[model samples]
Target: MNKNFNVIAASMIAYFAYRELPSDRLCRSAGIDKGSMFEDATMISEEKIRNLWVNAVKLSNDLLFGLHFGESLQLSALGIVGELIKTSRDVGTAITAAANLISTITPLFRMEMCSDEIHFVIKLLPTERYDHNDPVCGQIRDFLTAFTIHELDGLTLKKIRPVSVIYPADKSNVPEYERVLRCKPSIGDHVGITFEIQDWDMPIITSNYELQQLLLQSNATVKDRMSSEVSFKNKVTNYMLSNAYLGLPSIEQLSSNFNISSRTLQRKLSVENSNFQQITDNVLKRLAISYLKEGSHTLKEIAYMLGYNDPSAFSRAFKKWTGFPPATYQRNEEH
Candidate 1:
């Protein structure tokens, strides 16, 4: 539906911590407008959110930026979603609430939960594919895992350490993982956090059934409002945003998903004064800018993600879009 993230999680601490680094400059470097963050109900591009993490790490020179940022996060930072989790009767219910409300809180990723007799595993999958070697992605994963543990402990009033925190082998912050997680972290194929099964049933100290019911109603209202406001164009763009990682979809493919003929889809888009090609170009432009700004991936890597068969072709496309080669654009942004 808009492929956005609530700015509260990124901007709250950023406002105070980044005094020397103006938010406007950061937003521009990330290819987002500064005014987006100042709205009453601020919602920023998911790409901007990722770029923020990358830039924060670059500016702070902190390998543990995500872990450190998450360590200080309070329930208030998450708004109603945090409230819903805090008021749940048990840790299991809290986890469920977090899972259910994640799309409303942040549509950047999806949370998948699996449990065994001895352990419960929660895996974080990005709504789009990212470079596995990008440390910013790993750091954000670390932040989310650590933040979940921290929130659960706060609600249950116990120091509940996960059995293990697993991150991609390519992440550079190896030593800091153990320090931040307070457990031996494993380098693995999956990005997930595993906790002992016993903690799942732990009763929350702040559980309030009445308050939770009220929050649930409030959450549904928010979701409904969001759904009502999303136009068909946005729905198509959102789908493209998530699936662009695999490859950009053709008009025929997109129309098929909507159960419409290609001509019908074209007509609908024309009525909105837009077209599939324009939307695809916009998505590619945004991603190209974000990747260029992040500066971690090579031109080839970014090219592949944008569905280019060759780096030279992608470079030409990027130059046309932004009036500068990708490398030059990145260097200028750095300056």
Candidate 2:
């Protein structure tokens, strides 16, 4: 990735268009373009995408990032529709009625129940960036934590653990997690924050007698919304790893195989939060480390596998990346 990323008010734009703010200065500071983020998806890497989100939370100073954004759009739209149906039901009835009609609001991003184990998981597609304390992410977590607690009254999460974050958390936010989640939420790690529901079988406050049917339907919709493109990226990376002996693919070859224009292919990957060169480097780096650990291939063979014609050139590059030659790394590992 170019490392030039900008923080724009995309969610605000989605909510109150007038509230949208230009991220040009932020991008300029971060070395990215503000105007082209919506169009030039490749300009934003996953880390950068997540950074934008985290910045949003900091910019807004609110935890209900997702809900606030959603309220402006989905929830607001639902309220308009709910007025026609609001007078006809109880709280539970209103909830059930809202769930069915709110699919439009819930579709782009949402939470769904899965069996007795998982309460709600964030499902977002067509989003490139995500990070801890990301206004949207924080908003979703806050909404889930608060809504779940409010709805069940007795149900409260024991702890909130974040599996991923672009940056570390401060002490102030730590206590808030303890209070809100009834458990400390871990940040900068790769484990989901778990909320233990004592009565997993408790029914939602909805008019529908068959709560299972609604949950099942919602789960199915979430599964259906998941794109298969994530798997495709893994495949491409794996292919690069195995064929390291070959030189980098020309843009034409990659585009031809994927049935897309070179530019379109690049842009699509950017939307997915990465670019070809970035993935290629990551794959190569992973494979290079593994090969070094094995210590079986000769320098010449290793060089060839990495698409370098000369051992000396490969050694120089390796030293630059890892600050050690292959022989020294292999010997240290063996020791």
Candidate 3:
């Protein structure tokens, strides 16, 4: 919500990778001013922020960079910060503690960790729209790679593997993947980040406990304020069920249907834990799947339903969403 948050969030990644990529090249490609990225605190447009993400990905060849950046920053910094907060604890409590502390610094992402006796699942939720070019995403990948190594180094985790984003056996990036994960990397059908939970009972070694408690308390208070944003998010999701395919509606039109000011709608949705873009994607994914299954509509038809004008563009998006071509999805569904 802060004006300069995107630039700062994206730029810190440039800072992190500055040695590998010179400052001038990264800044020019990312469309950021060298000095202002760190100094300017003004809120930037979503367009500019998204462009930063796009540029970062194109320049770096990292698809999941923004998301990786988001998750890793919290994991590392907050893990350290949480250490100053409390004593030994379970993975769930430690993660919660770290999450609470990290939310204070940046509301761009949140994490949920849970288990059902088999393994621990950590869900990373982005609070804002993701940019394909965001250097932060790459930072995130580096962070995960680094954190996997750190946990292994700490002797808390013996092996680190990703259930998703598997590296190809014959690919050139295999060495990089192996070095980062510190284990044999397997690429599977899963699409997001997952770290193994071998020692759910590992002990944390940190000296500060009181600071952790205070950070948790503060997080609790902020969460209460943001709860309404969740409802607004759901409502927005419901609104776009059949509408997003028509075109992205104005906030005013959407708010009018709900009988409130667009400002009030946004405020409440912020509390409910959603936003327009997120809702739009939710609806689009659903609609795209549905249209694909019907077998009557062409790719162009599906794209138009999702508010795109061309079939080629739709095909590209479909591939991105499902990791398969539209024709492949249809053929498989038919079989």
What are the runs in model 3 whose C-alpha is more than 4 Å off?
2-17, 38-40, 44-46, 59-90, 97-112, 116-118, 123-174, 191-198, 208-335
| lDDT (Cα, tens digit) per residue for candidate 1, span 1-335 | 23225544343234213222344455556666544444656556566677777776666555666665565343224454556544678888888878866566454467889999999998877776555666766676666766776666546645678888777643565655675576767887766889899898988755323222322332222222123245556656655553343246788656643445789887878888999999889878876776666566678767875778799999998899989999899889999
What pairs collide in candidate 1?
Answer: none
Q: How far in Å is the alpha carbon of 270 misplaced in model 1? A: 64
Task: Please give the RMSD to the true structure for each candidate, in Å.
Answer: 20.6, 22.3, 21.8
For this target, which candidate reaches the highest lDDT against the unseen true structure?
1
Candidate with the greatest TM-score versus the true structure: 1
Q: lDDT tens digits, residues 1-335, model 3?
A: 54434434443343224212343555566565544543446455545554555665665555444433432232223334435334445544565665564454344556556665656655545556434354554444344344433332222212335444343232455554554454555654222345556545555423123322322332222112212233335435533441232444567656543435788777766776776656666666666776667666668756764667787887887787788888899999999
* Global fold similarity of model 1 (TM-score): 0.53
TM-score of 3: 0.39
Single out the weakest 10-residue window by summed lDDT for candidate 1. Answer: 217-226
Residue 8 of model 1, lDDT score: 42
What lDDT score goes with residue 257 in model 3?
Answer: 36
